[model samples]
Target: MKIGILTSGGDCPGLNAVIRGAVLKGIKAYGHTFVGFRDGWRGVVDGEVLELPREKVRGISKQGGTILGTSRTNPFDGPNGGAHNIKMTLVSLGIDALIAIGGEGTLAAAQRLSQEGLKIVGVPKTVDNDLAATDYTFGFDTAVQIATEAIDRLRTTGESHHRCMVAEVMGRHAGWIALHAGMAAGAHAILIPEQPVSAAQIATWVQEAQRRGRAPLVVVAEGFIEQGQEAAHSGRGLDTFGRPRLGGIGEKLAPEIEARTGIETRATVLGHIQRGGVPSAFDRVLATRLGMAAVDSVAHNRWGTMVTLKGTSIESIDFDTALGSLKTVPQERWDEASLLFG
Candidate 1:
């Protein structure tokens, strides 16, 4: 079989690992030929492709980002787009199937394409770790590790200056990164989107930490909103997918905390940095396993399915199952982490 692969949506740390894993396993085990689509669905619409052999993917497992690059180009957007055009392009290129490695939007697109009779399998990719079917995604571990390191470094400066520090991590619709990093870094307050916290509550936490002779460190998810002010804190704008851009929550919170508590406060938005570095050992192994499983699923004609991590093992599930709901930070998990807060 000749398989075509594409990495879509925002780039993450373990994307290259997934690509390498799939290519190596597909070539060696199934004798499958491969081609890589450039810049996500745009490549599919425009017929832009690159030859992906075993040699091409060599030494890429430790690398960050996708070798074929990525983009937010919607597959059904312009002229020559849509399922019929994509099918024609694949047929013209002699591609038998597709492996799409990306987060919700990409997988959702792949699911629609599969429904249109396209042979496509998905591998979940997100630094947010919000996909429902998977226990965890590839880039989430690396993201959490990076955010934790940032929090650790920020703690020293904050202590020296006797300031309240707010560190923001990514999570547009979820708070997994902030939750894990906050618990790991021993934050004084952890804020997430799941629970709308007020500025007064955060200021109280900071003041308590200061009273206890410790510099306050607060970890907040990018999507976190203050109670009763949801509509006022919009980020830059909407993206190609029509979702509101999320940022500046930490910046917005810092001044409020400072003014309310009468303490010097600073906000550091660890934007993009968490997703830009080398993946953690856990992410690499998990991505490789999922990639291999994706290829196996494709070979077995499991269209409309995605490869996912279920606890200690890799499993394949229908795309709809994965997309049915987002994996959010549950109240129990948040409660557990909150025990350490001031």
Candidate 2:
């Protein structure tokens, strides 16, 4: 059998591991031939391709970013989108199946293609861990660890300056990174999108910490918007794929906290630093397991299914189930994290 693979959306660590695992197993166990689609869906539309073999994937499991590269391209929005051309190109290339590795947007795209009669399998790859079916995505742990270390470092500087420090992590509809990293770093407060935290509340927290003669360290997700503030970003106020922009919330919230609390405040947006780096040991293991299971998913003809980590084992679920809805941070989880707030 011949298979095509592509990585889409924001680049993250452990992507190469997934590619390596899939190609290695697909070749040795199943004797399958592999082709790679470059730059996500654009490669599919234009028929840009590369051959994947064991040699091509060597030593990439520990590397950051994707060897095949990625893009935030939304194929559905264009008049000459790849979805239409993908079917034609696949037929011409004799590609029997596709393996799409990405987060929510990529899964939704794969589901759409599946409905169009394409043989596709998906692998969860969000650092946000917001995909519904998977218990945890590959890059979330690594991102959390990176953010936690950054918070730890920033806490020192905050203390020296006696200033309020706000560290922004990534999360659009979820707050897993902030919650986990905040807990790990002992942040004074952690803000997430799931919970609508007021600027007044944040200010009060900073003020209390200051009164107690301590610097306040806040961990915030980039997608977190102040309850009553307008949005600011460069994507025409759109998100990664034309949704209303939710970025710069940390930047917006910083000044509000400073004005309200009269404390010297600063913002540190970690931005892509959380996404680019060597995969942690945990992510390498998870990505490898997901990749191995993905190839097994193919042998079982689990078309339109994605490999997910549920508890201690790797399992497969239908793509529709995985993409049914975003796995947002639950209210209870936020409440538990809130105990440490202020």
Q: By TM-score, who's the top model here?
A: 1
Clash number for each model: 0, 1
What lDDT tens digits, residue by residue, belong to model 2 across residues 309-339? Answer: 9998999899767776888888888888778
With a 3 Å backbone cut-off (N, CA, C), the pairs that clash in candidate 1 are none
Best by lDDT: 1
What's the CA error at residue 263 for candidate 1, in Å?
0.5
Worst 10-residue lDDT window, candidate 1: 226-235
TM-score attained by model 2: 0.94
RMSD of 2: 2.0
Against the reference, the lDDT scores of all candidates come to 0.92, 0.86
